[model samples]
Target: MESTKTAMEAFEKLEKVGEGTYGKVYRARERATGRIIALKKTKLHEDDEGVPPTTLREISILRMLSRDPHVVNNQIEMPLTKSNRLLDVKQGVNKDGKTVLYLVFEYMETDLKKFIRSFRQTGENIQPNVVKCLMYQLCKGVAFCHAHGVLHRDLKPHNLLMDKKTLILKIADLGLARAFTLPIKKYTHEILTLWYRAPEVLLGATHYSTAVDMWSVGCIFAELVTKTALFAGDSELQQLLHIFRLLGTPNEEIWPGVSKLKDWHEYPQWKPKPISTCVPNLDEDGLNLLSQMLEYEPSKRISAKKAMEHPYFDDLDKTHL
Candidate 1:
């Protein structure tokens, strides 16, 4: 690791671009090289642990997965200023003497959320070719992670970074990703955004697999086509109802063992409607792939590797991607 005191002098924060539960993100520039980068500053307390285990897990995972172009690259350095911690995320003290961790990475211009909002604001649909390309890239990146035995339990538009110019998308924010090899462990159902969350997770199934991410991919696919969230829910129950109303209430017949999940309950039933009614603009092949991703039974849901081969993406030129 390089001397972070020198790392501190090498770059300057340009502006705060975003903020999340863990830290603030800045659009920064390396003074010496004139290279722009994104700086994620993770705050720590002197009274607490040296570094959060979640952050360390993310570092380990990113090191393994960043070789894929679709996964965001993480660059490492030593602690800045007066510090005793050994970390790749350069450490320093804030103005108030509070410890902070800075993670440096190549900057992306925008994220999927803002990109979709741009099209929505302009009353224009994201081009079909562009949608396919984005989704294909998403599947490819996701396949890479799953193939490596890691589960990115959370996948949403905000976590997907993109370059406004090339529309190249990269998966980020791996703090929520769990890399434990399975026989799936009982994780908390509390993970993932409600709308993108899998039906099994919403039903209180703790032992989830990679299918949860596929559900989010399906939601993102629809949002890209319609320029609106497929299912936007404010609460846990509301989220389930939104999904149930559209996909129709799930039962043992379609999603066996669903009724036995921890959060299972009696609810009003609705027959499954043709999936096309919602995304009327999506073509047959797109609908087919979306349906497979949104499958109620986790086991029946399509894998990312399988999804990348779907006919919906057959027209894409893979050489560049």
Candidate 2:
């Protein structure tokens, strides 16, 4: 216990960066190496059984994925280290007096949401080449996860971290991620953020697959181009409405089994709009790739690996990036 306390004391807490369902995040610097890291302090409930399921799941998935070369080499360049411990005097104390667990990760400068907001405020568009590079990296990371039988249920601009100097995009926040392999278990539709949530998930399909992540990628792609959320709905119903308005309402004919979803309802009928109409600046190839990702039918949605090969990224200088 004294050694754990010493280890925790090795890092100096810098500032609070953000908070989530599990815990608070802070920017901290190591006293020994002066290395910076993001410290995620997860609260442990006194009445709860053990470690939170989300934390266990995240730690396990990341452990398995951290071994993959594709993930370690290019995708979100952070090594997950659990050795460090910290005693939080403020928010870590439980009714039983047990301290919270702190997860240590290499520090990243910003996330995609903040990056997009900066561009929006500057009244400038992200360079098309930069978008291509970022999207390719995102697809690569997602592909690695899916190939490893993991599904990143929560994929959005806010969860995607980036190093401003290198312009490298990393997929972070695996709290909602799960393994989607054989003997599959039912998943909650209420997983991803509203704007990036897949249509099938929105309609309450509990038996979803990796295609859910693709839908989020499509939304992020559109956001990268327009510097705004493609479907910014305030509520779940409005979120569905936003999707239906743009892609047309799905039916038994178009998306088989969609009507059978638990939350399926008789939504207003609408015809699909041309992708080019909404993303006017997106070229033909970009539109084609985006359409495949945004397909209402989860089965029809393009896989992250397939998306990485789309013509939209044909000209990307992969070697340089």
lDDT by residue (176-221, candidate 2, tens digit) is 8888877667887764689898887787777878999999999999
User: Model 1: residues >4 Å from true position, as ranges?
Assistant: 1-4, 68-88
Show the lowest summed lDDT stretch of 10 residues, model 2. 81-90
Which parts of model 2 have CA positions greater than 4 angstroms off?
Answer: 1-4, 48-50, 70-96
Instruction: Single out the weakest 10-residue window by summed lDDT for candidate 1.
Output: 78-87
How does candidate 1 score on lDDT?
0.80
How high is each candidate's TM-score? 0.91, 0.90
